[model samples]
Target: MLTITLAQADGSWENPEQIRGAVAAFVKAHLPGNAAQAHVAVQGPAPGLRFPACRQMRMGFFGYSNPYGNQTVAVTCTTPSAWTIYIPVQLVMNQAVVVAARPLGAGTLLAADDLSIIRRNASNLAGSAVVDPQLAVGQVLRFGVAAGQPILASMLDAPEVVHAGQEITLIAEGDGVRISTIAKAMENGRPGQTILVRNSSSGKVIRGTVDQAGAVLVPF
Candidate 1:
């Protein structure tokens, strides 16, 4: 609903500023997501290019799915004269996202101090960029990340909670009764992952899900 003021001394030809303003307003209304900061850059019409003054103007996105990045908008006029013009518009949307606070190496266990949230242009960021510091914390980096670089989901992995041949607690519960025993993990396992383990007392192999506390829960 935001529009720019039109200053036309003679209502004879279409004003380039008017066209640019219309495109800017339309983009702002259709932009996706709540951007922390938005900037719309509209290119002016070429010099000497003139069209008859239109009583009404209609604007629409030209060959674009969403109002983001570099795009073209088609402006049509019908009343005094029927004409269409394509105006180029650039949309830069900034959003808060998680980024590495300092240079980190691969296999580094991320902690709260390793990350910081900052506003960055959404278009310039990867689609998998992490937005929450909690998501990056306690996770292991799959690759080295540069200082001040945005942390991406693909760059992290769940830390391995159970390692091969490691001793771990195995718990089983059923019918209001609980049982726990020492077990040796047969293979490495991450949080919530199921892996085979051998009960130390019985020497029996069983499958159990690794919990966040590094304990394995088996079926009763």
Candidate 2:
């Protein structure tokens, strides 16, 4: 076995480099994805920081360490059982995400012309930042958004495709056959929303999903 020796401070024993290396290894193993760059920043304890050095040092986290942002890491001496210290680390993660191209009001539909892609520092952005333009486009805003703002998942929703009291064509398909009927929507709904509709011919209410063409699909 090859024994690697780490350079230690004179008489005092503080292997800050070892701690940094350990944290780096841990971050590298946990970082997700190949597109974004992951970086872990850790500084050794202050020069005056005094503690008994142990042959075995272990690094632990206070909670789950985020892939990005500041974290408190625990460095402990397992063999000596003398002392433990916490180190503050900052992780910088940069990634690409979609942003609004123009100011949009609530209930505004997001189209391809309303979105742009750019590289950004995601540290300050919410966890719901939309990464794909396709996910943001064709969705309606739950709240107003400023131009150049990062589009968050919580800010968008599917716009209502069917409105209450509106007449819509209902299609029923079964066993490779299709049937069409007239129905009146009882409630507003989006493309995938299920709502009750009254069939004009049968005069009976049935459950169906709103379709893109202002129609409803009811399965037998």
Across 1-220, the per-residue lDDT of candidate 1 in tens digits comes to: 2223344426789878777778888877777666425798888677889988766778777885454467788888765678988888776777778999999999999999999999877665545678889999999999898999999888988999899999999999788887999999999999999999999999999999999999999877
Tens-digit lDDT track of model 2 for 1-220: 1112334434556566666676666555656675246667776676677775556666667676665566767777665445677777776667788988989899988899999998877766656678899998889999898988999899988889899999999999888888998899999999888999999999999999888777999887
Candidates in order, TM-scores: namely 0.63, 0.76
Off by over 4 Å in 2: 1-10, 34-36, 43-47, 169-180, 211-220
Question: What Cα-based lDDT does every candidate model obtain?
Answer: 0.82, 0.76
Best model number under TM-score: 2
**Each candidate structure's count of clashing pairs:** 0, 0
Candidate 1 regions with alpha-carbon error over 4 angstroms: 1-10, 64-68, 78-80, 94-96, 117-120, 128-132, 162-220
> What's the lDDT for residue 76 in model 2?
70
TM-score of 2: 0.76
Clash pairs, candidate 1, are none
How well does candidate 1 match the true structure in TM-score terms?
A: 0.63
